[model samples]
Target: MDLTLHVWRQKGPQDKGKLETYPAKNVSPDMSFLEMLDEVNDGLIKSGKDPIAFDHDCREGICGMCSQVINGRPHGKQEKTTVCQLHMRQYNDGDEIFIEPWRAKAFPIQKDLIVDRSSLDVIMQAGGYTSCHTGGVDDANAMLIPKPTADYAMDAAECIGCGACIAACPNSSAMLFTSAKVAQLAALPQGKPEARKRVLAMTQAILDEGFGNCTNHYECEAACPKGISVKFIAKLNREYLKTMIPTSTDA
Candidate 1:
């Protein structure tokens, strides 16, 4: 298949970027989207031109580094699929594809399709882990966690932090991602001790990092490659509210 690609090109953070058109010739339907880009880049290098810049690692799609907005959709039109996992067969020959980086104030464009996603790291650092001492490792069944609770935690843990939620949100909110992180820990016994602190800190970090607020558009859930649910956002809200209530210990 042959396709025309209009890809964003930016030299640096300060440089104004624009879309540059290039022809992708003889692309195989079996080729992944990133692989197709690699072929195009190889061709460019052979012609003494700078290759297109994009982020990709572990082409198997676990890394979430292969972040790209295909046409107008993050990770293309495929549901729950990352760009690296997206195959060329999904597109037809003679298609005009628009490729761009994730757009969010917190995630400023570094160059071309790569954006600085360190803001996400900052959010995670705020309170994404359990710091309490557990004394020593215990038996796997020692905690006796309910099956439903374990399932909920596992669901939230599936978030790969791809920032697709932010990209798809009208407000560019990080609520989905932040909520998933918060919910994952909050659901488990190990996370209960820091639930209040975790929820407060992470949500505050979201605002501090310049991420927008969630207005419940549900676009984040739609864009998440891992199929992270918006229900986590509700769980986050509940956790946050609990922090505001006064307990006898507080008194």
Candidate 2:
């Protein structure tokens, strides 16, 4: 199969980028999207032309390092699939594929399809963890947690911090990503101690990063590679509201 790839090429963050067209010949149906790109890069290198720069580590979908917008969709419109997991068979021969990087003020383009997602790392540092001493694994009967609550926590924990949610949102909101971090811990017993602090710090960090606010568009949920739901956003809101209200335990 053959494909015409319209890929964004930029030398640096300050450099202007445009879609450069290249023909991908003899593409195998079984080749992963990144593998096809490797073939293209090899051809470019042999021709003494600059290769396309895109981010990819552990092309297994778990790392979420493959961040590119394919034909205007975050991960090519495949439900619960990352670009690394996207196969060539999903497209037809003689198709034109437009690929670009994540567009957002918070995720400025570094070069080609690679963006500086370290802003997300800063937000995570703000308070995405429970610092309590969880020394050694406890037995099943030691801390009895309801199965439903544990399931919810596990579902929220599926987020891989891919930034696809922000890329998909019209407003460039990071609420879904932030809320996933918040909801994952809020649903668990170990996370209750620093619940208010975690929510407050994370919410502030997102605003500081210049990400837009969420207004119920739900695009974040649609673009998430892990299929993390927008319900976590609601959970985050409730958590924030609780922080604002005084409780019996509050001094």
Candidate 3:
């Protein structure tokens, strides 16, 4: 199939960017979206033009590094699918595709289709871990957790920190991503020790990084490649509240 790609190009973070069109001729339906971009880059290199810069690590969709906004939708409107796994078969011949990077105040563009997503790492570092040892692997296995609780923790853990949630939000909120990190640990027994502190620290870090607050638009849930639920946001709220109210043990 042949197509026209209007891709955003910027020389650097300070450079003003614009959509530059190129013809993607005779593209294969089996080609992954990144593969198609590779083909386009190959053509540009042969013509002595600079290639488009995009983020992509594992093309298998596990890494969540392929960050692109296709035709105004994060990850091209495919439910629970990342751009690296998106295929050309989703498009038709002579289609006009608009490609851009994650657009959020916190995710400033570094260049063409690449944004500095280290803000997410900062939030994670604030508290998204269990510093307390949970003993060895076998010891952890010996602790019998309720099946439902384990499933809930695993569901929240599915988040890949792709920042698609932020890109899709009207307020550019990081709540979904942050809540996933909080809820994953909050639901686990090992995570209970730091639950209160984790929620408070991570939420503060999110605000410090200039991420907006969640107003329940649910766009983040829709854009998540892993289908991470907004229910975790509710869990985060409960966790935060617990931190504010003194418990009997504290008394």
Taking all chains together, each candidate's TM-score versus the true structure is 0.98, 0.96, 0.97
| Candidate 2 structure, TM-score to reference | 0.96
Give the alpha carbon lDDT tens digit for every residue of 1-251 in model 2: 99999999999999998999999999999999999999999999999999999999989999988999999999886889999999999989999999999999999999999999998998899989888665887676888889999999999999999999999999998999999999999999888989999999999999999999999999999899999999999999999999998878887
Error of 2 at 127 (Å): 1.2
**Once superposed on the true structure, which residue ranges of model 1 sit more than 4 Å away at CA?**
134-136
Show the lowest summed lDDT stretch of 10 residues, model 3.
132-141
Error of 1 at 96 (Å): 0.4
Q: Report the lDDT tens digits of candidate 1 across residue range 1-251.
A: 99999999999999999999999999999999999999999999999998999998888878879889998899999999999999998999999999999999999999999999999999999999998656887778878999999999999999988899999999999999999999999999899988999999999999999999999999999889999999999999999999999878789
Model 3 TM-score, 2 decimals: 0.97
Candidate 2: global Cα-lDDT? 0.94
After the best TM-score superposition of candidate 3, give how far the Cα of residue 135 lies from its true spot, in angstroms. Answer: 7.6
lDDT of 3 by residue, 37-104 (tens): 99999999999999999999989988989899999989886789999899999999999999999998
Candidate 1 residue pairs that clash:
none
Score each candidate by Cα lDDT: 0.94, 0.94, 0.94
Model 1 clashing-pair count: 0
